[model samples]
Structures are given as C-alpha cells and as structure tokens.
Target: MATFRAELVIRNASVFYAHRFTRVNLAIRSGKIIGVWEPTVAGPEAEEIFDASGLYCFPGFIDPHVHFGLQLGSENCSDDCATGSTSAVFGGITSVFNFTPVLTGAEDELAALYKEVSQSTERYRTNLFMHLTVAEPKISPKKLVELALRYKFRSIKVFTTYSSSGRMTSDGYLMDLFKATRGTPLVVMVHAENDAMIDFREKKLSSDGPVKASHLPYLRPTISEVEAALRVCLMVSEMGGRLYLAHISSGKTVTELYRHFSALLGKSIFIETCPHYLYFSDAFLKGERAARFTTCPPLRPEEERQELLKHFYAGRIHTIGSDHCPFASWVKEKYEDDYLHMPNGLAGVELGFVLLYNLLKSRENEISVEELARMFSSNVSTAFGMFPQKGSLLPGADADITLFDPNAEWKVTLDTLHGRNDYDPYEGLKMKGKVDSTIIGGKFVVRNKQWVSTRVS
Candidate 1:
C-alpha cells in the first residue's frame, strides 16, 4: 500500500523480454527502468499511468543507420529532424544511429550537423546519436582513422562505390582505417561495393543516358558487391579489424560472404539488410513504380528476395537498418524520368519493425523473439558497443520501451505516415502488426494514438 515514487507506470502490458512474451508492469523513475515485475505489484508513486492492455511491450527499436541534414543530391526535401523523428516516434523507435558525413568543405558542416542534432534532440521523440565517415580516401588511411577518433564520432562508414567525398579509400587504406580504430572501440561501417567495377559498367552504359529500370542487370551489378566484399574481408583479416556491411540486397553477396570465402571475415564481419530490399524488387522497375524504386546497388530479382529471407531464417543475416533516405516527388522528378537517375534509398524507418514481426510470425512461426531482439536491438547495440545501456528494457536499462499490438492490422500509405517523402515503397502492402504506443525516458511520446507534447527526463 506504499505510494511508489516514480515518473510513470505502464501496466497490463504483455512483455517480450530478451524474447518470449510475459505479462508484466513497468515502473520508471527519473528516465531509468526501476522495476519490471508481475502486473499485480503495488503501484509505484507516479505522475501518470499508461495502460498497454492487449499489447506487446518490447525494447524500443534501435535503428543502426540513418542520415539527416542532407538533401536529395543537394536538393531540398520535406522532413528534417522534426518530421524524421516524428516518423521514428510513430514507428516505436527510441534510438536512431544517425549516419552523418563530414561535409565537403572545411569541417564547418560537421559543427553545423552536430548543432542540428542537438537542437533536434529536445524535439526528437527518440534518442539520436551519430557516426562519422572521415578516413581520407587517398592519403594515409591510418591518420584519417586517427582524425575520426579524435573527432569523437561513435563509428565510421565508408562507401566502396561512391567516391564523391573521398569516402572510397584504397584497400591498403581500408586496412589502415581498421587497424587504427581496432582497440579504440570504434567499429567500421562500409557501404561494401567496388567503385572501379561500377565505374566500368557506368562507362559501358554511357550510350544509355539515364538508363531504364531494366538496366539494373548491367549497372551496379551484384558481382561488384561480392568482389568488394571479398577484398574487404581479406583486408579486415590482414589488419585485424571489425567491419559491418551496409544494406546488402542480394543473395549472391550473402553467399559470397558465407559459402565461397569467409576466411577473410575472420569471424568479425556482420551483415545488415533493409526493409525495402526485403519486400520490393525489379518487379516495380518494369511497371509505373520504376522511378520510385531505384536505389544504388539496385534491388534484385524476386528469387533473391526469398534468398535474403532464407538468410534471416538461417541466422546468416544479423544486423538490420533503414538506410532511411527522403526524396520528395520534386527531388525524385529526375529519377522518375530515368530510373538510373533516381536517388537510391527509401523512407523505411517507420515500417521496418512491424514488417519483420509480420514476416517472422507468418512464415517462420518460431523465429525466436530473442532472435528478433538480437537483430533489432541487442545486435546493433553490441556491434556499436552500446549494449547494457541503450538496447534493452531490463530492470536496470533505460526505460525506453515500445508497446506493439500483435494483431493490429493496417495498410501503409503516404497519407498515414510522417516521413517527408510523398511515396512509400510499401504502399498497399498489408501489415499484420503495429506499435500502438511508444515510451522514451518514461514519457508517453505516443499515447492514445497521437504525439504527446511533453518531455521526460
């Protein structure tokens, strides 16, 4: 009968802990998890009570990759942190691995991007952190890694295919980037594709200006990615470094990593896949949606989509990300004219978790809830060294939590979403589950199906 002193209490929520669902009540105090016990436990003294009846309470999603403060190839778009975080909040994500770049000019963009993140922090319904990619592409890669470390970024991402910002460092340089950051607690995130191969293909296709949707077969081929992975894995072993491949869309790339030659990974390489890559494919390219579906390292055939699903089932795929890029119709106009000209990403943050739940629950009925946690939260946190503090909802972790309705059915459409992008890659696809409520730092950011205007802790 004691009055519990707490900020808030979420009751009657069926919890998914580590994996299995257990009915429990959560007590949060000062933004930290205070207690998780039987729902009948005495109510703690709290400012508010959130009823999560008929819902599944799981650790809020930890999106391992995201980028903001940049536009569609230098063009303005609709959402910034305000709308971006709004989408994340609605999606039940509590933390975002904000992927940032060291701008083209003097590092002034670095300071400005940080400022945007900080200002957006208070407004962000979710916690936002960043990773910086700054190993000089041509110079001493070791020194570039040192500079990235000195800059205090959480991680590093390099593009093996894009060299516009000097992100494509040589293999020797890649090893240097890794060897230098090895024990420094910084993990390397590589886009993982061969720039030279892509360049050759692009040149061969010069006669085909702004290529067609069907041209994906020749442009940015999977072989380019597989060959790059082979090279990086070798370099990683040679340098004793850890690397994570970003948004792998094809089965051949996964097989190349696991079957043909994984000796180079040395057991340190991790795999990441995106939602769009899972559901959509070249099918759209042949239809009216071609422009809406183009992405770098383009989407593969349907068989490949099933192959990725198999990888997830077999545990060969580990980490997952959104690669959430927003390009409004205005920005997408060029690409719409020519598939090859379109920006290569989609707004996937909001729909990711629910889709995964639907996939596992339907096809692979026994996909361990623990496994889901590992891929969505724990695995990403561990890969980035952010565990025990940010990814779990245990008694002592941050009280960031999500309440999902396993039976909630909804159709995804732009009219129903918060991202700035006007088109959704998942439009009309029926989803069987959804996050009904999201709590970050003990504050009910999404309550009764709307955004609440208050901050917690």
Candidate 2:
C-alpha cells in the first residue's frame, strides 16, 4: 500500500457516473481531480475533507445559453457576469457559454465581439466561454474562419428573428455560415424561427386592436419554430456541419429532428431546451401576470410541454440550458398594452438546477442520474469542445462539482434566489433537491446555500 496526499478529498459521496451511482472518495489537488478510490483502502490523505454522505455529487452544470450584460430594445439586462455567474454558482453551474451580439456592417466584427466577451471574463467567478452572434451582410465565412482560428471560439449563434437587435440571420446566409464552419470544430447554434412567419402573424394580430399579452402565443406559434428547425436540420445535414438549436420550445420541432436523427448523427446535430419550456405553458401568457411569462418562441400548449419532457426522458434532447436572460419587471410593464414590445426573457439561472431536478422527480422516473448529469454538464461541454476539462468528474479534470441534497425543500422567492432581477417567474413555487454546496476549481464558492466567496471587488 502506498500513501499519497491531496489538497481536498470528498469522501463517501453518492457520485453519479455513466448510468449508475457509485460511492467513492474523490481526491483533488491543484484544482484537479487526482483520483477516485475507496476510503477504506490505501487512499490519499488530504488537508480538507468533506463528508458528502446522503448527498448526490454530480459534475457541475455547464449552461450553454445565457445573455449577460445584454440589452433588449431600451432595457439593459439586469444581470452582468458578476451577478449572473454568482447566480449560476448558486444553481450548481460552474462554467457557462455566453452569447455576445455582433451586428451587421460593423467594422472589425470579430474584434467587437471579442470586446464584449472579454469584459465578462474578468468579472466571472466560474469558468467562462463565449458563442458569438454573426450579423448578416456584416459578417462572412472569412470572418467565421477568423473567429474560429483566431478567437478559438467553437460556436456561432444565428437567430432567425429579433432583427431589431440585428440578431436575425437569413436562411441563405445561415446555410453559408453552416457550410463555412463545416468539417471543423465549430458549431452553428440556430435560434430557430421563421422571421417572416412571425411577422405575418404579428401583423395579422395587430390589425384587430392593440397587441395584448394573450396575443403572444398567437403571434409566435409552434409552427414557426418547427418550420425553421426542420430547415436548419436540412441545411446542416446538406452541409454536413454541426448544428445546435437553442431554446427549442415545441415537441413538433423535436419530432422533426428525431425523424432526421440518423442523418444528423455523425454531423454532431444537437438540441437545447430550457426549463421554462418544460414547465410553463402558453396559458400563462393570458394570465394576469402574463408579462412575466413573456419570452420569444412563446411557451407552447401543455401537451407539447409534456411531449418535450418525453423526448428528454427518452434521451432525445441533447442539452438543457437556462437561457438565463434576466430583465427587470418594469421592463415588462412598459409593454402592458403592447405585449409585443415586452422584453423576452426570464431570470432562471439561479433556479434552473432545482427546477429541472424537481420536474423529473415529480414526473414518473424517466431519466437516470447519469443522464441528468449529461444533460446539465457533460453533453454541453462535449458540444462546445470544453469536455474533459469543464464537464467531467474524471481524474485530471477540473475540480468543479456540485453537492445536491435531494431531500431539501424550499420555496422560490426573489430573496431566496441570487440574481439582479426583481421578479421570479417561479416565485412561490416549492422546489425540492436544493444545491447544498458548489465548488469550482477546488475552491468553495457556495456552501450551505450561501455564497462563501465574492468575484466582485
């Protein structure tokens, strides 16, 4: 028997890996997992030991879709990297891939995008990565190459709507962008929706009277998303490039993608769905608090929400992102009579982990613990090329881990959650399986549901 020493040891934890659970001792040194062995055997000694008995330990979540320090219309996002990442850590996320907006006709588009991302990196407490939005006419395939080769960014975000923010990308240009990133490590993340389809519907609804919250679902129906998703799948398939559909809200789109699953298999086709989609419904859009529930690709019918859960349990949806675009409540109030003007986003980064975990537990068991780990962390890291380093609990991997207490129950409130936003869509809703502790880089940022360290000066 040999003796070894490590900086920290997480002992007797219920660790989820692959498709099952194992009780082991995790030895960590220099912010990396050094080994996983039995505590009773010849194992490493440590300066600090955490007894994680009865708690579940999974790899820290890696949120793939987030907008920090973002602006929508006249409203600036309430959460910046400091606040956003702090909230993220509270929810068990140790790393994030944020979106940086680049508009068309901007001189040196990549440089501008770099500046946006760089500003956040300095403020983020957890590991940070970025995916860029390339505006059409201003950005070209050559620019995409420069982004990938020079910036080392592995993904580009293209939207089919929100032209006001210069977020939209036309079909032709999207295909071109996909083709450009093809055969490379780069992935094209499409915010799937038909701009014209939504425009026509909004105009049709507007003719009746002033736009109201109830008209949201009518203006942007599930068909708009399905049509665009199918199109992106076809283009990516033809181009033989990787594609990631962000914030997918409907089952029809998932069904369409699954139909082409074989064709997209080796091409690295991936899909991301948010907690709001799985839990909320369009009916909420008609509620008195309608403005609070407003988001692009409006939540679909309840049945469709169920269908998405089925796909997730069946292992069809590749990853789950918070799409944590936070805005203040007053931003929605400004659009009272004009619902279309309301900012489309929610503050869910802090509650994402508990919401997803409780959703599965409430529904009859479908996904395994390992599968849950994959959806929240591993798959995201693998998709964005941050794998072994950011998503796994394997030896030599970064010591980013989350300790979850399945028996812990708590009520959702703005005070209980960490974020800069003033409201919580999930407010008053009781949640089970709270994050007990969050560790990043072998350092404790959150312990016992409280922030132990600060990234802000």
Candidate 3:
C-alpha cells in the first residue's frame, strides 16, 4: 500500500463528535478530513503537525443570524464583510448566515440582490451564506423556492412587526407562505412581535412623554411577543410548515412555547436566542450608554432573564445567534436621548462563545462541553442544511475546526477585540475560556489568539 500522507495532522485532542468527546488524531488533505483514529493507532505522515494536547477540538461554530454592512437610516453598520468575518473567525466561528437586504416584492430583483450580497462577501475570511428576506408578500411562493434553490439559501426571514417601515407581513400572507413552503427544505424564520400591540403601545408612550431606553420593555412588552409566537405556532401547526423563531428575548416566550406547542419544539420549530439576551438585562438600558445595549425585543427584566437561562439549561433553546449588528459609538450617541431613533443591536459576534462558555461554567455545572458544541456549532449547521459537511469531524467533512483552552482567562475590552466599532457591549467582563485557534478548510485563519492568513488550495 502506498504510504498515507496528509497535508496536516492534528494529534492528541479531545475531539467532539457523535455528541461525545474522545481522544483522537485527525488527518487532513486538500481541506477535507480524511482520518479520525485512536491516538495509539499509527499516525500518517504529514507536512505540518498540530499538537492539541489538553485542548478541546470542536467543529467550527456557525452564527446563523448576522447583519454585515447593514444600512439603517443615514448610517451604515460599522463592520462590513471583511471586518465582520475577521471578528467571527477570532470568536471561533468558521461560517455565517447573513441576511439579504429587504426584498422589494418583485421576483426580478432576486438576482440583483443575490449579486449585490455576493459581491459584498468577496472579502470575507469565513465561508458565507445568506438568508433571503421577504419583506413583502408580492413574490409568489414558487418563485421564492426557485430563487432559494438557485442561490442555495436554506431559510427566509419575515417580520410580524415593523409595519410602519413596510417590513411586516400580514397573517394572511404568512399563512399563505407557510402553506406554500410546507414539506420543503425551506424554513421560514419570523421576527415574532405583534405589530398592532406595538403600534398601540408606542402611540400611547409617545403621547405620554418622550420615549427613553428604559421604557423599551414597556413599549414592545413581552405580551406582544407571546401573542405573536402563539399565532405563528398555530399557523405552522395548521399548515405543517417549518418555523424558526429568532432572538427569543423573553423567558415567557419559551414558557409559552413549551406550555402550548411542546409537540413542535424540535420537530418543526427551532429557537434561537442571542448572547446579549442571555447575559445582559434591561438594567443595561438605564445607564448613560444605554443605547449600546438597545436591540429589538429589548432586554427583559432580571426575573425573566433568569427564567430564560433555566429553560436554556433544560435544553429548551436550540441555538445561539449573536444578532450581531454593530454601530459606531458616535452613531449610538447621535440618538442617545431618543430611544425610537436609536438603532437596535449590539456587538456580540466576537464574544459569543467565550461569554456563553463562562456563563455556563459559573451557573450550569452539569452542562457539558458536548452540549456547548451542539448549541454553538452542530445544531446551527443542521438547522441551515450545512450539517456534517460544515459542522462535523467525520471523514469527507470540511476541516473547519476550533481549538479552545478551557483554563484560559481574559478580560474583554474594546482595545482587545477586532471589530470595526469603538465600543464593546461586553467591555470589562471577565471571560473564563478563550479560543486558541480557528481553522477554516484546513487553513489557519486565526492561530494562538491572533489572525494569520493562509491560502488553501
């Protein structure tokens, strides 16, 4: 037999696969994993060897929700594809699913939008995919599916609020969309919030006084989210469609989901929550820099935050998305006093894994590293049709891997991060674990907590 030679070899690592960890050696050639064997087994010859002793090796993470180069009003978000991808890699994310600009309700615009988004991602260091946004119900379902197949997108996003901005879809339209896409590979993602309730509350709040950041929870209240989530559940249950709820903020939403729709939990409904919602609370919205913590479905109260964490530990949450939309500090400061005009998002793409790992270690001791892998990497890939290939260490899978040192400790600050923004929402927070390196398609994009450029053949 010809000698087995590999381009790269990783040895003596605790590799996560099949929902468990085991000591193994991996051989890679041409960006694909070709061997996963016991460490005692004779290893293949390789040009380069990576000793990962005592490190935990996981499939690279996938952030299913992100908005790179998003434009809101007159100012664009600080991180474009180049900078955002760099931040993602540094945080152990090897791939991302970014949303397209709002659709114009015309089928002809699909190609143009795809071209535009594809061009923007040309400089991304991580592999990039897209989620189509159906802002208007004008495009037919058949065309939506066709376009998705043409573009290889696995999901579509719609909103139940933001009607004033022309982003809301009516119940009739949503139902129609559900019925049309049922039994297909396409999953409909909803920003579930009752628009009518919001409009009424906002009008009342505006009439009473100028809206401040602290009044965010009242302005869009948890009841609105619960009602909308129930409505979507009913629609999906009736139509037998796939649904994904985005950035679930209130614990009440999770409670109501289990209370009413337990049957659909993983079978048809997938839930995603952001790190900000899990870590910070409305308390962050009271300080002078409250605008930095502002995001849609604004942070909830401490009681609700604690409840959310409980459900998360109980395995009610499916995945974690950063919802990473960042604005320059000055841009947030521009509307500091005006809550309505301030953009809704924060920077978490670079700190998500570290923050969550620390939170889990401190609070949920029973939660194992395997569960973290599922939340941060595998489950996300499975949901978006990128499984095994992008989220597994199996043979023939892409060699996208992350090396983590569970003992490493670091403090988060604006100066220590890599995004395009000047401020970090997690500034001053102590992190217990850190990403040691990130490899994408067998190329070292980040090594030793620093980024390095390596071209893959």
Against the true structure, candidate 3 reaches a TM-score of: 0.97
Q: Using lDDT as the measure, what is the rank order of every candidate, best first?
A: 3, 2, 1
Reference-based TM-score of each model: 0.90, 0.95, 0.97
Give the TM-score comparing model 2 with the true structure, all chains together: 0.95
Model 1's lDDT to the true fold?
Answer: 0.74
Least accurate 10 contiguous residues by lDDT in model 2: 259-268
Query: Which stretch of 10 consecutive residues in model 1 shows the poorest summed lDDT?
Result: 101-110
Where model 1 places Cα greater than 4 Å from the true spot, the runs are 1-4, 40-43, 103-123, 135-151, 164-166, 208-210, 260-267, 336-341, 454-457
Report the C-alpha displacement of residue 126, candidate 3, in angstroms. 0.7
Instruction: Report the C-alpha lDDT of model 2 over 74-105, residue by residue, as the tens digit.
Output: 88888988889999999998888887766555
Model 1: lDDT of residue 119 = 65
| Full candidate order by TM-score, most accurate first | 3, 2, 1
Off by over 4 Å in 2: 137-139, 262-267
Clashes of 2: 0
Q: Which candidate number would show the highest lDDT if scored against the true structure?
A: 3
